[model samples]
Target: MATERPGASDGGATPQEGARTAQQIAGELRSRIDRGVYRVGQLLPTQRELGADFGVSRDSIQRAMRDLQTEGWIESRQGSGSRVIRARRIHTPKARAGQPAPISLGPLISEAFEAEEVSLDACCLTAEALTDHVGVQADRVARGEVNPRSISLRLLLPSTEPKPAFPAAADDPGDTRPYERWAAMVEFHTGRLRDRLLALQRGKFVSDVDVKVRRAPVTPTHKLYLFNGSSALHGLYVVETRAMPLSDGTEVEALDILGLQSTLFHFEKTAFERARLIHNSLVQKVK
Candidate 1:
C-alpha cells in the first residue's frame, strides 16, 4: 500500500465525493499517460503544477499521485520527482495477418508519425535501432515531408549500476567489463536519440517534444515497442555466449543477447507464439 502524506485527501461536498475527485484525477492522469501526454520514462508535472492546473489543493494532487503510484502508472522518489515507468496500454488497429511483420523499423516508424500527436514507447537492450528510425522521422519532419504537432519518445534500458544480469563474463560471472562496455554503448545511442528529438523542438519543426531515457532494474529478455496508442511489436532476446572486446584490447567471453538479429512480430499475433512445447515439464521440475 502507498502511504499518503499528512493531508492528502481530495474530495467534494461529501466524503464519497472527495474519493471520487481523487479517482477522477488519477484516471485523467492515466489517460494522459495512455495517450502519450506523459510518455513512459517522463517525469510527470510537479504536484504544484498539477494542483494549479486542476484548481485543486496540493493535498488533492498528492492524493492523485499516490493513487497513480499504487497502480504502477508512476513512481515517485523523495527529491527526484514522480516519473512514469509504464504507459497504460490502449487498443489500436491490429496488424493484418498478410502484412510483412519482420522488423521493418523505418516503415513502421513513419506510419506512427503520421498522426498529429506521436507517442512511441520502446524497451530494448540497446537504443541503437530505435535511434536510427527516430532520426529518420525527425529528418522527414525537418524536410516537411511529415508534420506532427508533438512527439513523445520513452526509452527503457537495462540498469547496470550494482550489477547486470546479462553480458556477464562466461568464464567468470562476477566480471563487470562486458556489462560496462554494453552500458557505454547504450548511453551513446540514447544520447543521440535525445538530441535528435530535442533538436526538432529547438528548430521549431515541432511545437512540443519530449524524450526520456530511464533505467529498468532488470535486463530485458525481450524488446517491445508501443506506438500511437494503438500498435505494438515485440521480439524476444536470444542470449548466447559471444566474445566482447574491451577498450583495453582484451576480449572476454560473455553471455550476451544478440538484439540486432531478433525478429519482431506484431503484438496481436504474438498469441500462442510458443505453443509447440506440450510436455508437462512442470511435473518434473516442481514435483
Candidate 2:
C-alpha cells in the first residue's frame, strides 16, 4: 500500500468552508433575534458558550458575532458583551412630527400632473397618496380649471345623547315595525343635517368641497370634523351629553382651521366624484 500524507486522511474542506460555517452561525443568531428570543439591549451568549452550543470552534463563533455586529443586529461596547439593538422602523414619505401635523399635498400632486402618461396603476397610486394627505378624493371633478384656491369643505356631527324615545308599537297607528321605528329615529335626528354631515365626513363632496372626520381613541364619545380649504383645513368637534330640562342643543365645542391643501392634480373626474360620495356616506354614521 502507498504511504498516505500526514493530513491526507481528512478530506479537503478548504478555508472557504470555515467562512461558510461562520455565515451559517450568523444566520442562526439572526433568526433568534427575529423571533424575539434575544430582544433588543439583551446580551448574547459568550463566544465560547455559543461555540459550544452550536458545536463550532470559538473562532467561527467570533467571526459570526462580528458579522452580526457589522450588520447592525447587535452592538459591542467597551467592557460589555454583544447586545441587540432593535432595527429602526421604516419611515414613509408622509410621516410627520407633532400632533395634528399638517399633511403636505404638493409633491404628490406635482408628480401626478407632470407624468406624461397616467396609467391605471398611476391613478391608484395617486389616490393612495392623496389618502395620506386627506382621507379621500372627490368623485366629481371640478369643472373649469383646476384651482388650488377653489377647494371648500364642511363638517358633519352626530348627536351625543341617545335619541328620544318614540311611541310604542301599540301606541302608534301608522307603523310599529322595528325597522320603521329605527328609521324614524334616524331620520328625525340626522335627516335635515345628514347632507352637510355626509359632505364633511367624506374628503370630497360637491365641487370645491372636502371633508375630514377624525375619530380619536382617547375621546371615544365624540368625533372631530375638519372642513378643508385650498390652503387651510378647519376643525370642529361635537360631543354627546345627557339631556336637561332646557338645553340649547349640542354645540360646536371647538372650531379652527389650519393650512393644508388636498392633492387634486391629474385626478380623474369620475374617481373624484365617487371618492367624495363614499366618504360622505361613511362619515355621517360613525359618530
Candidate 3:
C-alpha cells in the first residue's frame, strides 16, 4: 500500500502512539490472513482504503504493511500494492549438520518421554493433537520400548461452557451443531489419552502419571508444545473451508481451522526472537 505520512500541521498522532497503532493494525491483519480473509496471492487493500477502514493515518498503515512484509506474510512491489506470499509459515527453524531431521508431533512426544521425569505444557484450541501423540507414547511404554518413572501433562483447552468462535456454521450464528461436534471430539480424545497414561501407573509400568486439564478463556490462534520447559514447538491454525458430516449424515460447508496439518516450527530456548517470545509467554501462562 502506498501510504503517505501525515504532516505535523495536520495534527497527526505522536511517534509513540503511531507505533502502537501500527502494532495493533499488524496483529489484526495477521489474524485475518490466518483466517483466510485474504487468501494467498491476493493483493491487500490499498493504503488509502486501509487507513479509512481502520481510521488510522496512512503512516500507520505503511508501518503495518512493513511489519507484514518482514514477517514473510506478504510481499510488496513498486507497482503491485502487496501480495500475500503465503497464508501460513512466517518462520521455520534452520537446519544444522549432525542433528537429526525435524520430527513430527508423534515422534516428538515419544522423545519427550525418554527422560526420567517427563513434563509437557500445551496450549491449543483443543487437546486433539496432543491426545493423538500421547497415545503413541503410551503405546511405546506399554510395549516396553521406553518407560519414564513419572509422567505429568498439563493441557489448556478452550472452555466448553462458552460457545466457541470456530467450527461455527458459515452463515448461521445460532447453529451450534459444529461446536458440539468439536467438543465431543476433544472430550473423547483427551479421555482416551488420559486412560492410557493412567494405565501405566495402574499396571506398575510407572510410579506416577499425572494428567491435568484446564479451560482457557480464549480460542487458540496457535498451538504450542513446551517440552521439559526447555524446547518449544509452535504452529499456527490456518482457516480452512470444507464440508463436514453430521451425526444424521447431512453435510454442510464450514469455516474452520486445522491444527495438525500445519507445520510445527521447532525452537530451542535461545534460538530466535519469535520462538523466545512464545516460549516465555507460555511459561508465564502455565504458571
Which predicted model would earn the best lDDT? Answer: 3
Show model 1 residue runs off by greater than 4 Å.
1-101, 268-287
> Alpha carbon lDDT of residue 132, candidate 3?
51
Q: Candidate 2's residue-wise lDDT over 1-287, tens digit each?
A: 11222222364324676687788888888888767788654679888788677766677778898887666566675666776653221111332455343222322332232222211111110122223222211111222112232343232322223321221133333433422433343344333333432453353422333333221112122122222211222222222222212123432222111112221212223566768978998999785
Winner on lDDT (1 vs 2): 1
Q: Model 3, range 21-130, lDDT digits (tens) per residue? A: 89988998888877889865577999999998787888899999998876666767777588665555434455478743343454456568898899999988767657
**lDDT scores for all predictions?**
0.75, 0.40, 0.77
RMSD of each: 21.8, 22.1, 17.0
Tens digits of lDDT, candidate 1, 16-67: 6556667778888988986789875577999889877776667667888998
Give the range of the ten consecutive residues with the poorest summed lDDT in model 2. 118-127
User: How much is 206 displaced in model 1, in angstroms?
Assistant: 0.5
Looking at model 3, which ten-residue stretch has the lowest summed lDDT?
Answer: 1-10
Q: How much lDDT does candidate 3 score?
A: 0.77
Candidate 3 to native Cα RMSD, angstroms? 17.0
Clashes of each: 3, 11, 0
